[model samples]
Target: MTGLAKPQGVKRMQVVIHAGAAFTDDGRLLGSLLANKAALAQSRSLPLGPRHSRQFVKVMSDSVIKDVPVDDAQEDLREIFPEDLNAERLIISSDKFFGPRRTALQHGQIYPFAAKRTAYSEKLLEGAQLELFVGLVNPGSFIPKILMSLHEDQRESILGSTDLSCLSWLNMIDDLGDLAPGVKLTLWENEDTPLIWGDIVRAMAGLADDVALKDEYALLLSLLTGTGKTQLLELIQQGTAKDRQSLRDSLAGIFEDHAQPEQIEEELDLPGWNSDIVSAFSELYEQDLAKIHTMPNVRVLHP
Candidate 1:
């Protein structure tokens, strides 16, 4: 990463930061990850981290969200997290860095939402010792949520001015690359988050496979039906304990058979789309993800 380097005497430092492509994380991942604090204490690979992780990050990066002066922020933050803090890494997340995502504003397909704002946030964080993590969603469902949340007139204005048919988030990711070169990027599809919840938390915390990520199954439980969850647990324990890959295969089979119809259904009940168009947009999104996987120094989280 292109930021302040740690002194030789200190452990080489790293920071894991998640600035959401809005509506993706919603702070739940952070909540679930922090729940592992007790087990994390016993983890050998994970480093000792900030005592109040969420608070420390929020306080230090509040300027990035609120658009305050970076210089003032640097001075004030040092007071709160003096050099004596023993943490080698920090787990930070915020959705606000991308600006108001659910607004009645659209800037067209090529430059849809938060392009400039995201670049600005990166600029604000310039020279900060941190790596970047982001969750991207398909514009297929993303647009509906934004329209639903806005005033009718505002929504109309956005629809009138923007070409939703060609929307893509590749530009936004590219914007980050242009603005913050040398920063490590970790990516995952928002829709697949439940399947890879444990993996995401472990990667974000810079922990090893053995360091358990608490509430790893929390997202799956919320998304799956009661029968599915029970069946999955049974499959996991029915025979002798299975390897991670075997367990994952068993879980996937269960999920495929029993995933709730409502969870799979994407009924916007709003305008500007049909089943075919939505499907096409979704395919395009998958393609975008495939392209992202090919980028150098980028970590694409998987199940």
Candidate 2:
């Protein structure tokens, strides 16, 4: 005996949350998705822009902090995403979802509150499917970037007693899986983003196999030399690299010859961080990435 009869057999919405671990996309990914917003809408997926995503984050944060019930949180979301929404999938991209970048290294851990925040995000999803997409960077570069983003006083406070070697993306992933169960987690290396950007966009936008978006190679092209860019574009135009793997394979060869090393290489200069430490962090990162490749409840997208 309800006030209004429920609609029969309507599909549930699927929510894709891009929870940044920071300095990964730097808003570029969202920018790329926004570029294809028209196409995305045609495919029944709405990529929430920065304003909408901020509103969503604020609503979820208030609910989590104020102990607001799930129903109330959902009602708040309805204001942002109307009940008559025409999309089957909603995409929200925000690095802040992992917490502020300044607190990234707190308690000797990377994104210590990621799992908890993710759980809160899930609570507001109502009946929709939730997918968490996280982009991870090597702590060698990741730590330096984080420090550079913080003020002098804030850096030391966040790095309190933290052993840099102890930071592991694998651990963060495990925590996300254990603490935020029932949500699919998709991961890719920031280093490999140039190669796999197409797949990432498709997954985030919930695009069908035949639905193609423009500028999938924008990142890859930026790092390419003049000739490299020409050949890569020609390869795509001529159907040489017809699929994701084939394109990746072709791009790898081109990168060897035409990638601008200066653009591809990240210059690292920070207090107490040297070549040796960076190398060690990189080695550990590779090892962790290998282990993550085999983990359950996770999908690791590779170049």
Candidate 3:
């Protein structure tokens, strides 16, 4: 794999493809071929005959917006626009779409077509250099569902961060991979982890007609991660045969109500104790249980 010399200011563009249709099997195959061809063509195309610098045009996807500036107009168009209009320029065409919805584009300058028209009502045509062309394409059945799962607020936050432009182009792709896996693990481990420890405490207290479950819930809160909860539960189980059985039964009942048996098994099979889960426990401890004893109808059975 030959490394393409990093283009000047290439680090500024960190575009991610959130639209699911962009990752189809055919799309992947085509994109791979295009990337390779572009890379190879770029190397040979350099070192112009009479003019040492050659004018080259490259078509990039919306993912490129992550690294490139989208907010500041000057910075966003620096590479594509002429430094000196007289100088022989390299025209790079970025096929990025800016819309009101969540996109990989990080720069603030490029507004969604609708936003551009609204914000700069009169200057829309004069200020906007790029034209948006929409085509009817089948984006797959699950595309809408995937977009919906990525909440609008969270998506907007990620897309709107100015610091996001500093992120490496490669890292943006890696982040998408990490996000899917992280969410999947979170779902799988929901049973073992104390994600809903408060609800469990309330339910148990109501059912048992005793507030002792609140203390147990507080203890369980300290074990927020799957590994921590699993290990802590094991330690508690070792106290006595009766204690072990009782604790196991309580946990099993809670798990059954919240998650499927397969999910519990999957959580158990996951490797290692991630520190992020520990941090989650710390956050919950600070935010939710700062004054656990002061709460009404709550009893402290175990610290």
Best by lDDT: 2
lDDT tens digits by residue: candidate 1, 167-285 = 78777667667766656788888877877777777877777876656567767766678999887667645854367777667767777788888876667756756777778988999
lDDT of 1: 0.64
Model 2 sits at a Cα RMSD from the real structure of 2.7
Would you list the rank order by lDDT, best first? 2, 1, 3
Clashing residue pairs for model 1:
none
Can you give the TM-score per candidate against the true fold?
0.80, 0.92, 0.21
Per-residue accuracy of model 3 over 83-153 as CA lDDT, tens digit each: 33221111111222223234433443212232222222112112222211111111121123223435777
What clash pairs does model 2 have?
Answer: none
Q: Please, what is the whole-model Cα lDDT of each candidate in the order they appear?
A: 0.64, 0.82, 0.29
Return the lDDT, model 1, position 64.
58
Provide the RMSD of all predictions against the true structure, rounded to 1 decimal: 4.3, 2.7, 23.8
Count backbone clashes in candidate 2: 0
lDDT (Cα, 0-100) at 36 in candidate 2? 93
lDDT of 2 by residue, 1-303 (tens): 011112568676788999876878889889988999988888788888899898888888777778998777877776567756777788899998878787688776888878887887776775677899989899999998888889988877766667767887766777888888988999999888888888889888887755777898888899999999999899878987667677778888887789999988888767788989999998999899888888877888887
